[model samples]
Target: MIVRITSKFGAVDAVHKTPHTGVDIAITEGTTLRALGEGVVDRIYDGSANIGKGLSIKLDDGTQLIYGHMNEVKARIGEHVHAGEIIGLSGNTGNSTGPHLHLGMKATDGSWLDPTHLADKVANVNWINGPITQIWGLLREKVSEITIDGFTDYLADFIVAFPVIAVVSGGVYALVRILSKGGATWAAIGTMIYGLLIVK
Candidate 1:
């Protein structure tokens, strides 16, 4: 899913007193949030002055990821969480102008890192691949259930009238294509051809 970035790291606007420390993603209230990397929940904040109802996770590489402006926090302190695991829900809480998710990252050296730059490295879930694979499997199974004998029996009458069907279908296709050019004469001819086929 494409997420709109409401605020970018280091952007200094009227709303931000200081250079923004994190990227803000525009989201609706109660939207599910997921962990970006394998991490252990280290801190859970409740009604903090600035980051209300948020949580922080210490990643395997020692980097700390902070999620702010949440309505609910699902991960508990010291609990291990993998990438893509549900962590919380986005909300307009604590010092937020609207419903959005504030994502901040601190490097192992304690320096603030831009979350957008490292997004791909931490996001492990392939949202498109798994479901598509399952759907393809289902389609293959349905196709396999269609036996030649069963198909032949189902369309036995059509099979006997194949030559006539082919000729009529070809004529209809040609008539429609010619009609696309727009003329009363072609339309009349198409109607007559259709009527003849229906009568036959």
Candidate 2:
């Protein structure tokens, strides 16, 4: 059973979506958006990316669920969003022809997934549950910052290969990055506790 489909599956005016890139949910403006699964908010934008003004949530299993072209964002990065929870309002914000909700999912490896594939699945690890490792690593890539992403990833691949230094340093760095992003004032600070430390 298709929860949603194009307005015109056969007609010329039908919502023609790209092949396997996204799930086109036919909803008019002001439709309530729900979470695809349990996970933390990854990012929220006001019509920034090609997907338009939407939000991204990563499940505990590393699968990423992205909702695009929205009228409102009800979730924020780092917040543990639950399945079926309302996260936003559907609309035509991005490169869309009309008001609708585009739902897409991807694995931790960044492989695209479909609504059917998301029916029963799980995230293997909590990328956000730890410190700000991923965030700090990402920021450090932009500037001359010290991060523990490599070390953490290495440990993830070979748990015993990494020593205590990696864990301690990675945690410290992530804490600093979280503070930089925003300390206690942040909603999802828990997701970025494994970032790197910055020196100025």
Candidate 3:
């Protein structure tokens, strides 16, 4: 979890007389924003009346994190961001009264969750800098790519083969009945028609 975090959840603002939606980390403008976890950048929206310039990241565990009131967005849409990577910069944007980073978290269904819990849950893992580690990481990424390709091929094969196998088996059963009834020629024609119907 982030021990360097500043604000607490549900912190009330005296001027606006309302509780905040997420925790605010007071920081100077252009302060580097780091990803609390590994996730893909889901959205990067321009500043608005409410959130200002903000970015949304969807984590591997399906949690959606929102970093609002940014001075700049460094992450791109659909880009995979690793934990501790600089995703953006902090600033007073949107409806904010001062410079701060507004951190919010949501469940898979978009239900609000306490941002503190997520920060507390994440262990700030230190990087092991070495050539071997770098090589291993690259190889792991390649393995993941290959795994997805294999699954796609398997699914495609099953889709193409299932109906044909079912039709052939049914035709064989029909042919057996026709042979027993002394109607081999008609049954062979019917089997061809059945095969055509299956193809269509």
Number of the top candidate by lDDT?
A: 1
As a TM-score, model 3 comes out at 0.54
How big is the positional error of residue 74 in model 1, measured in Å on the Cα after superposition? Answer: 0.7
Give a tens-digit lDDT track for model 1, residues 10-66.
Answer: 989987889898888755566667888899999998966687789999999999999
Of 1 and 3, the candidate ahead on lDDT is 1
Cα TM-score of candidate 2? 0.51
Could you tell me which 10 consecutive residues in candidate 1 have the lowest summed lDDT? 191-200
Reference-based lDDT, each prediction: 0.70, 0.58, 0.66
Candidate 2 C-alpha lDDT tens digits along 1-200: 11234432222433443454665654446656677678999888778776788988988988788878898998878999877777877778978876566777777888776654432221112212223433443344334422588555544644443344355555655666666745432433332232222111
Give one digit per residue, the lDDT tens place, for model 3 in 11-94. Answer: 675633566667765444665677888899999979975888989999999998898889999989999999888787777789
- In model 2, which regions exceed 4 Å deviation? 7-20, 116-200
Which window of ten consecutive residues has the lowest lDDT sum in model 2?
A: 120-129
Q: Per-candidate TM vs. native?
A: 0.60, 0.51, 0.54
Ranking by TM-score: 1, 3, 2
Model 2: lDDT to the true structure: 0.58
